[model samples]
Target: MPLHLPHLRSVINSDGAAIFDAEQGTLTTLNATGAMLWRGIEQGHSKEQLLQSLADATQLPEEQLRLDIEEFLEQLTAQHLITSE
Candidate 1:
């Protein structure tokens, strides 16, 4: 699935990322891991690519990484930060 980001402004830093939803007037904060994932999303990475990237960055199992990414994507969807197409 491709992710669609709408009306979101973000600042990614070394420590984490801060995302602002101008349409919703809400702010969301993310940790370092989330910052990496957000960068991938902005770069138009596929789910598989994201999993591979995480696998490359961490010593975790691919299955676990998949689940984690799914959960994170779901949370982003729930918060109206992203939509899957």
Candidate 2:
């Protein structure tokens, strides 16, 4: 499944995350890793690719990264930030 959103836009910054809505006047920030992973995701990487990238980039386990990526993607879906098909 592809997790994509129709109503939200995200931009990465030095701090972490910056999710803003002009109409809603909402700006949300995520943690350092969240921002990095979100930025990685924005780069159009696949789930498996994300796991590999995170594993290599962070020197973490691919299995753990995969699981966390799943949870993160689910969170994005729950927040209506992503749509899966």
Please name the candidate that would achieve the greatest TM-score relative to the true structure. 1
Write the residue-wise lDDT of candidate 2 on 1-85 in tens digits.
Answer: 4454444577777777877645456666778777877776666667777777678778988778888989988876666555656
Put down candidate 1 lDDT per residue, 1-85, tens digits, no spaces: 6474768899999898999999999999999999889889988999999899989999799999999999999998999988887
How many residue-pair clashes does candidate 1 contain?
0
TM-score of model 1 relative to the true fold? 0.94
Model 2, global lDDT: 0.71
- The deviation in Å at residue 64 for candidate 2 is 1.4
Global lDDT scores for all candidate models = 0.89, 0.71
RMSD of each: 1.0, 2.3
